[model samples]
Target: MVAPRKYPLELRERAVRMYRTSDPRPQIKRLAVDLGVHPEALRGWIRQAEADRGERDDRLATAEKEELAQLRREVKELRRANEILRTASAFFAGQLDPTRPR
Candidate 1:
């Protein structure tokens, strides 16, 4: 399960917007201190905003990343279920064999 974010969505958007609109982009650490957020977190938000705007292509867009995570979880669940079913099928087949004593 995803953990709740410490910073609200509005706050993140505002910070990213401010960073984008500033005449001279401020240093990430300084801006983070002013906003009471970690510098690395602030930098991530900026990178994500740029990716959303098509200005950067260094990483997957947010939606794509989320979808990928969801898909990976589904694949894992499927693999687990397949293993359980395979084990059950083998057990049932052995039970039905007349060659073995009950």
Candidate 2:
């Protein structure tokens, strides 16, 4: 399940738009203060917005990150199931060996 966002989408979008349009491109820290958001958080939001708009390509977009996370989880679950099957096979093989001690 996705966690609830601490800040609303509207606010994030507004912050990014303001940052982009501001004269001289105001510093992240100062803009964050004006917007009542954490500087680092605002910076990350701006970066993500830019990436989504194709203004930046250095980082993964939100959808890509979510997809990557989902794929990673599926891989982890498959690995765990594979390990369980291997152990079960080993145990069953041992049980079927007639020469093995009871």
Candidate 3:
């Protein structure tokens, strides 16, 4: 299950909007203090917003990050299945050995 967000969506949206709509970009630490949010959290929100708007190339957009996470989960599941199959194959091979036990 997804964890509840620390800050409400409306607050996050409003903060981002306030940051974006300013004539001169505001300092993140100051804005964060004004908003009563952590400075790092505000920085991350701005970076993510920029990524979503295609204004930043160094970070993945939200959709891309989600897709990447999904793919990683699938890969982990596949690896687990493959390990199970390998163990089963080994067990069957041992059982089939002609002279092992009676």
Q: lDDT of all the models against the reference?
A: 0.93, 0.93, 0.94
Pairs in clash, predicted candidate 1: none
Q: Which candidate do you rate higher for TM-score, 1 or 3?
A: 3
lDDT of model 1 at position 50: 90
Candidate 3 per-residue C-alpha lDDT over 1-102 given as tens digits, one digit per residue, 9 for 90 to 100: 899999998888899999999979899899999999999999899899999999999999999999999999999999999999999998898889977774
Report the lDDT tens digits of candidate 2 across residue range 41-99. 99999999988888898999888889999999999999999999999998998899989
Q: For candidate 1, lDDT tens digit of each residue in 1-102?
A: 689998999999999999989989889899999999999999999999999888898988888889999999999999999999999998998889979765
The number of clashing residue pairs in each candidate reads 0, 0, 0
Score candidate 2 by lDDT.
Answer: 0.93
User: Which of the two, 2 or 3, has more lDDT?
Assistant: 3
Worst 10 residues of 3 by lDDT: 93-102
- RMSD (Cα, Å) for all candidates, in order, is 2.0, 2.2, 2.1
